[model samples]
Each structure stands twice: as structure tokens, then as C-alpha cells.
Target: MSKIYVLDTNVLLQDPHSIFSFEDNEVVIPAVVLEEVDSKKRYMDEIGRNARHVSKLIDRLRETGRLHERIPLENGGVLRIELNHRSFHQLQEIFVEKTNDNRILAVAKNLSLEEQTKENGRAVILVSKDTLVRVKADALGLQAEDFLSDRVVEVDHIYTGELTLYLNTDLLNRFYEKGELSLSELANHPFYPNQFIVMKDALGTSSSAIGIVDHIGKKVKKLVFNHDHIWGIRPRNAQQSMAFELLLRDDIPLVTLIGKAGTGKTLLALAAGLLQTEDLGKFKKLLVARPIVPVGKDLGYLPGEKQEKLRPWMQPIFDNLEYLFNTKKPGELDAILAGMGSIEVEALTYIRGRSIPEQYIIIDEAQNLTKHEVKTILTRVGDRSKIVLMGDPEQIDHPYLDEYNNGLTYVLEKFKDQKIAGHIKLVKGERSGLAQLAADIL
Candidate 1:
């Protein structure tokens, strides 16, 4: 049976092509949605960029027919602008504030009633990215759904980067004897590429052998890069060990790290980058950049150069660099930074036009970015460049982002199965006991 999906403004802002996501279903766009998009199009951020993209898509669709009238789509569905929905009259009774949310609810409620009496008896659903809007729909006895096209992974089913599989002692013996074993000898199991493996005896007789398998689970490889310390830092967990392996692997150009505050996401990546570029001589330079999204109010119009204005937002990066350099005196780190012309710390604002090659790029606070911004960064990777994106989805400062829809999650979802990328989620907080307890209990 066909369904009618009414899109809310947040849905489009979250994903510009959300209109086409309901591919074969009839999509309804309330006039209020356009108004909201228009209001956001002038901002100089990801939301504004997506709003403009949505407007362009809608404008292109106008060539087929007027947006106010239902038009046939190539997918045998319809796109419509619901200007005559009757729920506006009913909403005035309860919500007299004339807010955007109230207007959207009114349209949704009226559409649900209209679709019930249609010739084909289609079901009407209000599709929103907002939790409160869905609650309002449920209160009105209407079917509602969250815009789920952006979700990275199913709840409770996220990637763990570790796998345990049972193998006979003989097989383990052969693996140890031969220094390698084919994946065909192992039993079938769901294993992601470069996933760390703990091969247990299954009889509980001895310590389990730890190893890593290729994405296809074909070849088991031992962890050989046993550095006592990475640039004077140590791996906090097994997941970080796996992340370090992935980061050092030249074949894999992409790496992602996720964790809450104080989990050492930025510290680990920066240390690895420093080791790779300055110590290992793999890359030519160490480049670090992150988006500018203040936690609270925006700091408008500072009188300074680019780096000075960005100093407040990029101080966290500087703090990590200072620790990695191990400088004792004040301004000692600045003296080192001045000498290392190869190291560049800039904002994402100026990264669009240049092509970076032979560099170790670290993008911190990636959760504040959008899917488009992330793409722009990735697309700028020239040959022999390794890029690491690290951020906590829970700490996003972008207004339109959440745990499920941030760019970091989006990259993890999109490129997880590929061989060139690796991801890890750091669960335990290593900053302090109180911080970890708060992360768990509060």
C-alpha cells in the first residue's frame, strides 16, 4: 500500500536530499517547511549550506510541475505542497502561539485525516527529526516516525572492533608454528576488516591467543608494532591498541575515533600524527583543523588575524600539542611551533580550496561538522595523506546535530565496511574516576 509522508523542516536540515529518500512514496512538503528552510539559508554554516541545497533541489523539481500542485515523480510517486490541510483550524484551539512547531503539527493532523478517506486509503505519517514533534503527533493519535535515513548504526548493535572466536589448540599451534593461518581454517563468523581477535581454546585450559584478522577474515596477522610508548603516551585500552594499529597501517588512509570528554580521542590522534610525521618520517607535515562551533553564544567580530580569532576555539588543540611536546617553560611550545614550519593548525574555514598531500591530517571535534563538511575534508586528501577524524557524538555543538546524525557517525556508517577505513568507540573515561562515574550515573 502507498503512504503519504509529511516532512518537517528539521528532517531536511539534517539531510538535504530527504525529499528523495521517500523514493516511491508520496512526499508532502508543508508551506511552513519552505519558510523554515529559507530562514536558515543565510547562515554561514553547514545548516545554511544544506538549506540552500534543498532549495536548489526543490527549484529543479519545479520544472516538472508547480510545487503547490501534486507532481508525478520519476519513481512512480508524487511530490506535493500541502497548502489546504485543514488541521490549521483545529490547532488554533490548543496552540494559539503561532509557532513553527504548532503549525507543523496542524498540517500533520489534517493530512492524516485527509489520507484516511482517500480512494486508495493511504496512511499518512509525520516524519520529523525532532522528538517533541513526534510526541505531539502521538498525543493527537497520529502515526509519526523519526527521519531515520541518517542513523549510523542500530541501537545496541554498534561496532566494537573486537571479536572472540573459538579455535582448536592444534589450529592455534599451527598458527603459532607457521606465523600465519588462512581464514578458511577458522569457522565462519561475522568479523569486520582489521578486527582484533582473541582466540580462546574453548576448553578453558590456557591463556587465549590474541590476533587480528583481515576484513574478509581470511588471514590472521599478529600485532607487530609493539611500541612501548607512542610519543611518550600509552594506549588506554584494547580498542586504542586496535586504533593504533589501524593508524600505523599505511594501506588504511582513514581512521575514526569516538569517545566522551577526557577519553583521550584528540590526544591519541595528535600523538600518533606527531609520531608518524616527525618521528617516523612517513608524512611531510602534521596538519590539524576543526570546525568552529562555540559551546554557548557566538563570539562575534574579533579584532585580530585568523589565528588570533581562532585561538579561543582552537585552544584545546594547543593544549594537546603542549603536552605532547613536553615543554616546561611558558611560551616554550610556541617557540617549537614557530620552528616547525611543517606543522599547520588552522580552522576548517580555509581548507576548502587547497589539496593536501603527504601529510597527517587530524580533524578534532568532528561531531560539530555536517556530512557535507566531512566530505569536503575527505575529498581534499591527496595521495599518501592519512586523515584521522575524532570526536564525541554526545558533545556536539552544532544545533542540528545529535548522536545519530553527526558527520562522524555518518562517516562511520558509510565507510565502515570499506578496507581503507577503521573506527573505534572508547567507552571508559580515563580522565578521572569522578568523570567516569558521572558519564555512567549522571
Candidate 2:
């Protein structure tokens, strides 16, 4: 039997097309949700954009018939706006407040009760991205679920972009001798383009060799830039070496790096960008940008001009650049940036509608971005440009996004098969022993 799904405001704010996700079911939108969405439609962020998109979608649907009545959808589902069930008395003993959450709960509780009385009733499930709302719904004996349509993969099963293969001693010797091995010579495995591989001795020996899948997907080739130092920075770990292989290659235009705190993701990306743009002159300029999401409580409005206001958010990028430049003074790095004329650091907000050509672009803290936001950033890439997106998925600050649904993981999963894309998940922390311990235990 078809079930009934009542959506929360956060669901639509996270994804505007969630209304059609419930196939062959009845979708209910509480009137309060529309009110909340309307209030957010005027802002200038991802949430605001989603709110406007939702409003336009619902308005387009209204052309067919009244939203208060059942309107057929293209996915064999029916949608309606619930106008009644705003009575607070039903939940007055437990939840006395007249908040929007309570109003939505009241509607869901009434619908669930009404369904229980019918001879053949459909299940009423409240879908929300808010954990507290789902908890309250459960306390009131209503079925509650999370909006899970946006998740690209489960947290534990996410791709690590590296695989270990135990090979026979003869095959390993042959790979070392020839500097490359055909995929047909190895066991049948699902290997993606530019994926790192560690071939070890299967006979319980200590010998091993590292290789990466060629873009053609038919051969595993030796690392080319493993021995080169990029901008006076060297890869400290095997994964870092794999990352450098992807970053230095001109053939691969898209690279994604994911790791925990202090895993050298940002530092390595900046080093590679500086080397390619300033040293090798491979691109016209090096552009570094990041989303401006604050950690914990926000500081409200910042002071000074655009650059000054952006300093705090972009300080991490500057720190990495300072290390690469060996600068000691406070304003020395800024002077260098101004003198270079080939390097630019800015926020991602102003990147929309701009076509970036022949540049090395790095987007840090990409885990805070939504899928649509990342798509917009990627579409801005012009001819002969390379874009690197690096972030710690476990350290997201966006209220509406989680590790599995964030833009970083979304791109890693979606582009793992493409020849022009490469990904690496750094596991070892090369910053300090204390930082590694904190990352592990804390």
C-alpha cells in the first residue's frame, strides 16, 4: 500500500526536489513549512537558493489544481498542502509551545491517528533532516525518518581511493623490470582510473611496489613525479606521494583529497598549485578559494573591507602559503602575493558566473558545500584549467550536510571512474605526534 510522507522545512531547504522522491506515495507539506520557506527565500546563500527553488516548484505545481487537494505527480505520487490540524490542544500536555515544529508535529500526529482508525490505512511517516524533530515525533508515537535521498554512500563504506593487492613474487618482479604491468596480468579486480595500488609479495615476503592505474584503465604505471619536491615541500607518506602524482599530472584536471585534521591536504595542494603556476608557468594564475562556514558560534558581522573581513576565514590558507614561502613577518606573505600577480585568494561566494581559464584552482574546506553548490563551482572551470578540491569530511560545519552527503564525498564517488579525475584519502597525520594522537583518541 502507498504510504504518507510529511516533509519538514529543512528537507526542502537541503534539497528542493525531495517532494518527488517518494514514489507512488502521498506527500504532505505542512502549511507552516511554506511559511518558513518563504521567510528564507530572500537571503543570498545555498539555503536561500533552495528555498526559492522550492517555492517556484510548488507554484508551478499549483497551476494544475489546488495545493490543498491531492495533485498527481510525474513519479506516480500525490502531493498536497495540509491546511488543518493546527490544534495545539492535542499536544498541549507534552508540548505547550506554539512553535512551528509543534504545529508540524500536531499535523503529523493527527494524520497518524486518523490513519489508525481506517479499515485500510497507509503509514504516516514524518521526514526531516533535524534530529530533534524526529526525536519528538518518536516520543509522540509517530513514525519518523530522515531525508536520506541525498547521501552518495554510507560512511563506513566510502571509497578510500587506494587498494592493496598481494601479488606473486614473479609478477612483482616483472612490474619492477618493465616499469608497467598490463591489467590482464593481474587478478580480475574493479580498478578505477588513476587509483593507487600497492602490490605486495604474496609469499609472505617483505618486498612491495606501488603503482597507479593509467588513464586508459589497461595498465598500471610507475609514479612519475614521486621524487620531485614541489615548492620546497616533499610528500612524507605513500598516500602523499600518490596525491602528488595526481596533482602534478597535466592530464588529470580534477583531483580530490580527503583526510582528517593535520593530514597535509591543504598544504600539499597549495605547494603543487604554487609550483605549477609560479615555477613551471603551466597556468596563467593560481586561485585558492574556500567556503566561508564558521565553526561553533559565528562572530556575527566582521569589520573592515572585503579582504580584511575575509582574512579570518582565509587565514588557514595563508598559513599554508606562509610555510611554503618561508615568510616570518606578519605582512610579508601578503606582499609576496601582491608582488607575484599570479596568485589570488578569495571566497567562493563571488565565484558564480565567472569563467576561470588556464588556472590552477584550489577549493579548501569543500566539505561544507552542497552538491548543487559544488556543481556550480565545477561548471565555472574554463578551457585548460585544473581544479583541486580538498577537505576533511569528518569536520563539516554545515548544518544541512553530513559526511556522506557533503560535496567532497559526492564528487569523490561520482568522479572515481572518470579518466580526468583522481582522488586520494590520506590516513597518516604528518603534522605532529600530538596532533595525530588527538585525531585518533579525541
Candidate 3:
């Protein structure tokens, strides 16, 4: 049976193409949702862009037929703008506020009641990204669900970029002696290009070896820079070693590093950027950027010039740079960056529409970006340019994103099968004992 889905304002803002997601079902957009979307269309951020996109989509649909009435969608679904069910009598006692959320709930509740009287009643489900809205919907005895069409993988099942295999002692020893093994030796298991593998003895012995699948997915090769340090930073764990292998390789232009707090993701990327751009001269410059999403209550309207205003937001990047450069004085780091004239640090907002060729780009805190935003950033990559997107998926600050659907995880899963990309999930926190304990338990 075809069901009826009521879309919340956040659903459309999260994904403008959500209208076409429900196939062969009826999608209802309460009138108040339009108002909320209109309110957000004026801002200069991702949310504003999404809101405007939604408005344009709805406007284009309006040209075909009246939105207030049932309109046929391209995907065999029915779309309608519900305007008559705004009455809040049923929710007046429980939810007194005439806010847009309550108004949306009223529409869903009324539709549920109206459908139940018919012999063939379709189920009414309220779809939203807000957890509190779903909770309040359940309190009102309405069927509510999270908008899950954007999720690439479940949080528990997210790819860790590494796999463990138990091999016979002979095969393990052969792999170590030759420094590489053909894909035919590992035919029993499937592997993606550049995926890290830990080969252990099948007989429960202490023998083990670590290697990465080649770019063609046909061989397991030893790490090239497993021993060498980059920019005075060495890999402290197996995962960090794997990250270096990916970061230093010019053939693989895209790399993603996912980890919790203090996993050395940003540090590793910056170190590799410095090594490649400054020491090796492979790239012309090193460009580091991050999305501007505040954690807690934002300190509204920071006072200063452009760089001064950005200093607070970009301080984390500066801290990593300071450690790498060993700058002790207050203005020493700024002088070093200026003197080098090869490293550039800026926000992600100013990166659009620029052709960045022969540059090493690192986007820190990438999990705060949405799918569209990430795509925009990736499309900016020019010839001979490498981009590394590193972030902690669990530490997202974007209101509409989560661990499963954030830009970092989305890219990790989408490029897992490709040859030009590599991913590593750092498990250990090398910052300090206290930071690791907090990341584990807190």
C-alpha cells in the first residue's frame, strides 16, 4: 500500500531533492514548511543555499499544476501543499504554541485521523531531522521517522579502511621476503584499492605483517614511507603509518582520514602537506581550510579585520602549524608563514570558483559539510592537485548532519571502490593519555 509522508522544513533544507525520494507514495508539504524555508533563504550559508534550491524546485513544480491540489510527480509519487489542516484544536491542550513545529504536527495528526476513516487507509509518517520533533510527535501518538535517504552507511557499519586476515605461515613469510604479494594469493577475500591489510598467522602464532593493496587492487605492497618521518612527525601506530602511505603517494590524489579527537589526523595531513610542498617541491603551495561551524553558543560577530576575525576560527590550524614549525614567540608563526610564501591558510568559504592546480589542499573538520558542500569543494580540485579531507565524524558540529551522512563519511564510502582515493580511520589518540581516555569513555 502506498503511504503518505509529511516532510518537515528541515527535511527539505537538508536535501532539496527529497521530494523525489518517496517513490509511488504521496508526499505532503504543510503550508508552514514553506514559510520556514522562505525565512532561511536569505542567509549566506549552506542552509540558505538549500532553502533557495527548495524554493526553486517547488516553484518549478508549481508551473505544472497547483501545489495546493494533488500534483503528479515524475517518480509516480503524489505531491501536494496542505493548507487546510492548520487548525491546532487537537494539540491546543498538549502543545499550546502555534509555532511552525506544532502546526506541522497538527497537519500530520489530522491527516492520520482523516485517513483512518477510509476502508483503505494509508499510513501517515512525519519525516524530520530534528530529534525533539520526532519525540514530540511520538508523544502525540503520531508515526514519526528520521529523514534517512542521505545516509551512506549505518554508524556501526561504517568502513574502517582496514581489514584483518589470517594467512598461513608460508604465505605470510613469502609476502615479507618479497615485500609484495600478488592478488591471486588473496583471492579468498575481496579488497579495494589502497586498503590496508594486517596479515596474521592462521595457526594462532605471533607472526604478523601489514601491507596495503596496490592501486590496481592486484597486489599487497609494503608501505613506502613506513620508517621515514615527514616534517619531523613520525607515524606512532599502524593506522598512522597507513595514513602516511596514502598522503605521500602522488598517484592517489584524494585521501580521507577519519578519527576521534586527538587521533593526529590534522597533524598528519599538515605534516605531509609541508613535506610535499616545502621540502620536495612537488606542489606549488599548501592550502589548508576548514568549514566554519561553531561547537557551542557562537561568539557572535567577532571584532577585527579579515585575518584577525578568522584567527579565532582558524586557531586550531595555527596550533598544528606552530607545533610543526616549532614557533615559540607570539608573532613567530605569522612571520614564518609570511616568509615562506608557500603555505596558505584560509576558510573554506573563499575557496569556491578558484582553479587550484599543483597544490596540496587539506580540509580539516570536513564532517561539518553537507553533500552539496563537499561536492563543491571536490570539484575545485585542478590538475596535479591533491586534496585530503580529514575529520572526526563523531565530533560533527553541523546541526543537520550526523556520523553516517556527513560529508566525510559520504566521501569515504563513495570512493572506497575507486582507485584514485584512499582512506584511513585512526583508532588511537597519540596526543596524551588523558585525551585518549576521554575520547574512549566520554
How badly does each model clash, as a count of residue pairs?
Answer: 2, 0, 0
Best by lDDT: 2
User: Mind sharing the TM-score for model 3?
Assistant: 0.98
Report lDDT per candidate: 0.83, 0.93, 0.93
| Candidate 3 per-residue C-alpha lDDT over 258-305 given as tens digits, one digit per residue, 9 for 90 to 100 | 999999999999999999999999999999999888889999998878
Clashing pairs in 2: none
Model 2 Cα displacement at 383 (Å)?
1.2
For residues 1-442, write the lDDT of model 2, one tens digit per residue: 9999999999999999999999999999999999999999998999999999999999999999999999999999999999988888779999999899999999999999889999998899999999999999999999999999989995577788889999999999999899999987887988999999899999989999899999988999888875467788888888999998889999999999999999999999988888889889999999999999988899999999999999999999999999999999889999998998998999999999999999999999999999999999999999999999999999999999999999999999999999999999999999999999999999
Alpha carbon RMSD to native, model 3: 1.2
Candidate 1 residue-wise lDDT at 238: 71
What 10-residue stretch in candidate 3 is worst by lDDT?
Answer: 222-231
Q: Which residue pairs clash within candidate 3?
A: none
Model 3 residue 110 distance off true place after TM-score fit, in angstroms? 0.7
Among all windows of ten consecutive residues in candidate 1, which has the lowest summed lDDT? Answer: 153-162
- Please state the error at residue 232 of candidate 1 in Å: 1.1
Q: Following a full C-alpha superposition, what root-mean-square deviation does model 1 have from the true structure?
A: 2.3
lDDT of 2 at 255: 98
Q: Residue by residue across 1-442, what tens digits does model 1's lDDT show?
A: 8788999999998888777778788999988999999999998877788899999988999999988888888777889987876356877776677788888888888877776787777888999978988988888888999888777765746565667778888888887877667777776766666667768886777846667776665788787678469988898777677778777888779988888887888888888888889888999999999998888888788879877888888899999899889989998988899998778898999999889999999999999888888999999999999999988887887767878778888897788778788777777788789998887777
- List of clashing residue pairs for candidate 1: 183-218, 193-215
Give the lDDT of residue 361 in candidate 1: 94
